[model samples]
Target chain A: MELVVVSVLGADRVGIVAGIASVLARHNANIVDISQTVVRDIFSMIMVVDISKADVDISQLRRELEEEGKRLGVMVGVFHIDVFKYMQRI
Target chain B: MRFDPREIGEVLEMLVFRELDIRAVTLSVNTLPAIRPNLKDALDALSHLLEPYARRLRPAAEKVASKLGVRIVTVRLAVSPTSIMLEPLGDAKAAVEIAAFLDELAGRHGVDMVGGFSAFVHGGVSRGAAALIEGLAEALNSTERVAGFLNAASTMTGINLEAVRRAARIVLSLKPHAAARFAVTANLPEDVPFMPGAYHGLGQPDAVVNIAVSGPGVIEAVVRSLPDADVRTLHDAIKRAAFKITRLGELVGREVAKELGVAFGAVDLSVAPSPKVGDSVAAVLEAMGLPRVGAPGSVFALALFTDAVKKGGAMAASTIGGLSGAFIPVSEDAVMSQAAAEGAITLDGLKAMAAVCNTGLDMVGIPADVGPDVVAAIIADVMALAVHLDKPLGVRLIPVPGARPGDIYDLGGLYGRVAVVDASRYSKIPLVARPGTAPPGVERLKKG
Candidate 1:
């Protein structure tokens, strides 16, 4: 499976998740898992999305998500899931 | 979440906020095969051999970096030490010509820098080594993208004071910011992905990709997160951070090497720092509760930091190479430069720190008027330490033009700002003028 870990971090707001989810949905990327938290009073969202079926490539999806994230006043990063596995896993 | 939210969040925080990134992805290309008896043929062969690899480097690095979302700064190329390549030609002018060609090649192909204009003269200077050393000033001065290293001292070969003197003289002749691109090294590693020390060893395969990881900011954040933690706990925290950083380096190196159709070499676990405000090894020490970087407990803090990183990196990567200790480049790290500017750190203090650190006397700016003898003496001091310690160390001194002690030279952009530190107290030393290789350290005499 071509999985990606998309993370968003910024000030707390209403449309941050909606803005990101819509972009992923429009690209046909399926969100498999999501977890949001307010750590140190800063809002952060982590989403594992299956990008294999996406209409756009990872770069295009990243750009759209980032643009939407900027509109929602957050910083968004899209990385292949292996980045996490390689770093965090034994 | 597929993984723990905290784990994902931590990785993001390190990447996004903590200034963590792969410092360099250096492709080590063996250029010995390109050497020909004729200078023109040699240049042609070298050009043909390296151009394709150089051309692919940036794109491959970018492809891996974009896919992994880990920024790989500075895609560099390291070749076999130019002295060896130019030896057969027996022409001093050939060094400058080759340097210019390599500089152009690097620039045209989007390679950030090209290393390995180097000579291994730890024992004695050969005709080829002498030629390379002779043309070093001109070659480095004229070339923007080429970096050079002179291994004047090593554990097995001892300290070559004559070679050190020659290197210092070359440093004196270099133009502004040119000194930043060259180094006089002791026990220079063949596969360190950092310049101006990287070189393809004779032992290495035709090509390999080595990664240098920079994460002083990430480690500092880890240290800062444990404000009241015990000493061992603090060490463990640092280890965990270093593990992740090395893993990132390994991943990037493997992917880039695969993309370029080369072998993955090793990850240099050096916690290299940039000139950015938060990205500093000194800051990491400060975060470990030092009132300032050069405060009393600084050495102990650095030792602890480096040891933990080595341990973490050892566990994380299959093969760890290069200068795996934390780098304390004065100008390139904002805090260290500030410490130097504030008189919190002196040349002697930095030398003391280098006793335990990876690189020695790096990117330090001294008074412009300081004689070659003084610089030679300093290089000799560093060489002596490296010989005794049997470790890798390098000295990159910038003799800022017309600058005095306490004056700040703003070289700007990655080379960063340098505060001129005093080296005049040792200026009268005539020991370096005594031309001979010093005997190896006591470690060499040890028997199993």
Candidate 2:
């Protein structure tokens, strides 16, 4: 499976998760795990997704997520899971 | 699979806030095999061999950067020492032509710079080395995308004072900014991704990929996170940060090499800093509790930090080459430049720091009146230190024309601004005039 980690950070607001989830659903990406937290009104969400079945490639998915994030007033980043594995696991 | 939010946040913080990124990914191409009896044939052979790789480097680097969500700064190319290619032709004019052609090729292919317009005269000079040296002033002065190096000292071969003199003269003759593109090295490593010291050594493969990681900001952030931690704790924290940083470089390097269909070489774990805010190595030292970079305990602080970086890099990557330590290039780092401007760091103090760091007195500006003998003496002193420590070190200086001590020469952009440091006190070392290689250091006896 093509695993990826999607992160969104910004000022806390409504529809942050729903906005991201809708994009992922439209692309047929499966969110396997998610953890989120808020501190001093700043919101951060991390999601691990399997993009193997997604119609869009990683770059295209990133652009779409980023555009959605901009509409929601947030910063979004999508990275191949191997980066986390290399930097954090080892 | 378990995912820790804090771990994810830490990686993001390192990237977004600390400015952690890969500074350089250099493709070291072997061009010596392309040399022919005539300069035209040699140029044709080199163009045929190098064009495709240059065309592919930037795209491959950008792809990896996008995939990993990492910022890859500069893509560079290093050729096998052009002096060797000039050996058969035995023409100084050919050296300049090759440098210009490489410069044009690099620009055409979007490569930032092409290095290894070099002469390795650590022990003595050869006919080709002589030709290259004769034309170095013109080649470097004329080309914007070509970088040059002269390895004039080594532990095994000793110091060549004559070569040092010649290198200093070349420095004196270069245009104000062109000196930034030149370096005189002692025991320069082969696979360094950073110019102007990088060159594809004789021992390297035909084509390979090497990487340089930059993370002074990350290290400083780590140091600041532990406000009350002891020295050992700071060391551990820095080491951990370096491990993560090197891993990123290793991953990017291997992936880029795979994309380009070349061998994955090594990760150079130099904590490179830029003039940008929050990206200063001196700031890391200050975060570790030194009041300033050249403070009394500066040497100890540098030693501790450099050793921990190497330790962390060792654990992170299986194959490590190049100068695997911190680089304290004066003009390129804001805090370093400020310290120099404030008289907090002198050229002598920088020399002391280099005993523990990688390159010696790099990117420093000196007065134009210091003379070649004085500059050569400075280079000689760094070589002496490298021989004693038996490690690689180098010197790259800019003698700003018509500038005086305490005057700042604003080189602008990555070159930054530099404060002219006094080299007059040591200005009259007669030892530089003697034209022979100093005997090899006692450190070489270890091999026996």
Candidate 3:
């Protein structure tokens, strides 16, 4: 309930950020932190969202983000924070 | 704790895109109190007693997995073995009733399986044990969720030829649909999560939770990235990947256990494979540079992978029970099935690899014409390997009636598909291998 990890990756294109943000906002998952960059025309972004007050379940948010990602020709992934802490720590 | 985006992104990739999952979370419950005679008076009391213990099982598991974005393949239960509970009744009819009762509980809770409709007869068999074994096919055939196993051999006990033969005949008699629900195991641990072999051993706590973690796709990705690395680096990479995968299981398992107020038993670090392309253990082996799973250099490939998995997983979890190694179940794995389909991996080769890996001749499909004696022989050979090597092993062979070797035997879904595998030419063997009169080290080993 504290925060969820959301990552997006694909070719740099128009409205990728707005598209992702609008969907997240609509679900009431407030973005606590955001980082985005375009390297060699392939765009990558990571957002830390606080979903303690989100309007939808994590699975529903994931489904919507995936659909928007498809429309934007990108791949979106939403995962629990434990995945990050366990795999990256040791 | 906040995590760096790049580090977290990599983990998200593994979870979201790589098919990582907590394969199963099994709740081992105590059903001893419900063991009563099959009378009108007892059936009503038994259901009332079992209802409260399992009432929240499925919901608790689902809530926890959903909150964490973890995909839990199944929620199952392992009760006290049925043979002991029905021993006093000495009625096969009562045993069948118990099996149906358990399965009904599972259906109501939407649980995937309920194991421990089983008997351990390596030491000796009794009248009730015989009744359960003879009634096994009927019990399993009648229930969708019931699972049964016959542990006929153990490392310390040598082998029980009689039990092995009886188990083989029972397997042949099972309704084709019941094949997936029954297993013949050797040297199984107390807290394994795989079915249809999982049962709560006498030593286990009354209400413990065991987690079976599977991530073949994640492991294959690691091996694929280090294509040219030497043996040392490859081993290290595998260890690192296994550590991460098993840690996920421990974390999720502990949380689920805590939420359910049950004792956390162990993290079973078995790398489960399915028919899916990337999820096969054989695919992970192929990623390690073998052309295919059964080609030259395949056995050593499995040896390396299995050892590294155990080494790495042990570092992550405090208690690792179950079959904690890479499983090579044919029909359940695409590469293994393909290897059998092409005749690249023979049944003998499977036995040889079984010595080095976790299980023996697992999920193997043989010719429909093969007799019960031959099937019993194969199982006995596997039993011997487990006792000699001091490892836990199981046999889940499928005798696909009307299907010849190399033909596709499709059981469908998670039971998967297997190409019928050719066995060594059968030779006549005694119905029960004559027991040795007085083996030298047997008593001392049993005592120790």
Candidate 4:
């Protein structure tokens, strides 16, 4: 199983989590952890998900997520769990 | 279970509309003219000098605004005293020409306000400084973004009756549209990073950054949440909140200075407020048990609030300075403005309040016909208080054109709006004319 972290940031609006979650669920990704905070007009969220489905490619999932993010007026970036953990340690 | 749409709408509104976090970006630019032989050449130099800075200023400001997710209300510039450049302009025509040049430059550059069309004749008035004062009304009236100031006295240099007298006349004659942009001061500090008072001094770096952190809402929210808190408890809570706010301000100011590669000037922890509901300096005073800001106990309340804020801010940052007190700007503060409009506060009430707070007679709109000597007298009273207390204080009263007592002038924007405050009909009391004499100092009390 491959673990990944997805970070999203943008103006606080409707359907941000549901859209991202729907895309992840379609790829058979299991959400493990989620944290979110709203400060002023901006919304920020971090999600950790497990993606072990052999049929879905990580690169293809990233493209789909990017499209979803653009449609939702949010910025989304995906990173390997190991890389995210390393950056956090620093 | 069913959810109410009204409740959801209310929550969304609270999230999006209720939360306001905007920072005022004041760009300090020196307007001391580059060496030039003719007026045309001088204007050209002015535009040329500003062009480079202007090109990068708006974009950088917009980027910061976007990143912070807060609106940048103004992209303003503060120039060195125009009096320095007006030395060669011997007559009113020549002075007006300089004003025109400045106005044109400001318009072309898309700057909202340009300060430093001023003179600092604390002890005595020079020829050029006097000329700037004489032409001030015309210059201010003719220009859109130009602001003016006059430093009438200082501790080092005694009060200049000449400058004070002239400033009074200039302010009285100033147009209503331009009145908000003009300020008069005694002992105006050299390193002020705000305007219509910022002027790059020789002691400052070629470029320096200053921040004015304003969150009256935060303070008010803290106070309101503890409705049953005692005065001491309330003061303690305010201090803690102020410490956090000032620390955040210091961090942002330091980062911005690092990015600009200039010295980080002080973080002015002035609780500057807007006309928006629930953000007010007077509300803080009201929370302290005063029915209104001008009540009998108001001055003492202000003293406590001001002292506590300074104590907390000083502890928060090493470089805490500027007017680091609660701003009592009448028009800018919704409650104070309302009080003035309802006749709950008067000009004398404001003067009494200034004894404690650093700002005296700030943004208080008055009549145009008010004599300069009377204005000088009012300034003298406030200056004497500052000297007596040995604390920083300033007076920025606006004598709105064609306005009188009971008239309201709407300045709009961050300046907010104000109803005209009635001027004191009484005259001055005779006092000694000594300058630089230290007042009786208060002994510091040791806390257990």
Q: Please state every model's RMSD to the true fold in angstroms.
A: 1.5, 1.2, 2.6, 8.2
Docking class of 3: medium
User: What DockQ do the predictions score, one after another?
Assistant: 0.83, 0.83, 0.56, 0.07
**TM-score, chain B only, every model?**
0.98, 0.98, 0.95, 0.86
- Evaluate candidate 3 by giving its C-alpha RMSD to the native, one decimal: 2.6
Query: How many clashes does each candidate structure show, in the order listed?
Result: 0, 0, 0, 1
Any residue pairs clashing in model 2, and if so which? none
Tens-digit lDDT string for candidate 4 (A43-77)? 87777777876256565677788899999999876
Is model 2 an incorrect, acceptable, medium or high docking prediction? Answer: high
Candidates ranked, most accurate by lDDT first:
2, 1, 3, 4
Range of the 10 consecutive residues with the lowest summed lDDT in candidate 4 chain B? B439-448
Error of 2 at B221 (Å): 0.8
In the order shown, the chain A TM-scores of the predictions are 0.93, 0.97, 0.93, 0.90
What is candidate 2's lDDT per residue for B1-448, written digit by digit as tens?
A: 4568788878888888888999999999999879899999999999999999999999999999888888999999999998899888888999999999999999998999999999899989998999999999999899998998999999999999999999999999998778999999998888889999888988898999999999899999999999899899889999999999999999999999999999999999988999999999999998888898899999999898999999998888869989999899999999999999888989899999998999798989998878888999999999999988999998999998888877899988778888888876766778899989998989999989
Candidate 3 reaches a DockQ of 0.56
- Distance from true position, residue B253, model 4, in Å? 2.9
Tell me the tens digit of each residue's lDDT in model 1 across B335-439: 989999888878888888998888789999988789889999999989988888889999999988898877889988778898888886756677778978898
* Model 2 CA lDDT for position A22: 99
Best by lDDT: 2
Q: Write the per-residue lDDT of candidate 4 for residues B245-328, one digit (tens) a residue.
A: 565456556645555455677777776677777768788888777888788899888887887788777776658656677788
Docking class of 4: incorrect
Best by TM-score: 2
Backbone clash tally (model 3):
0
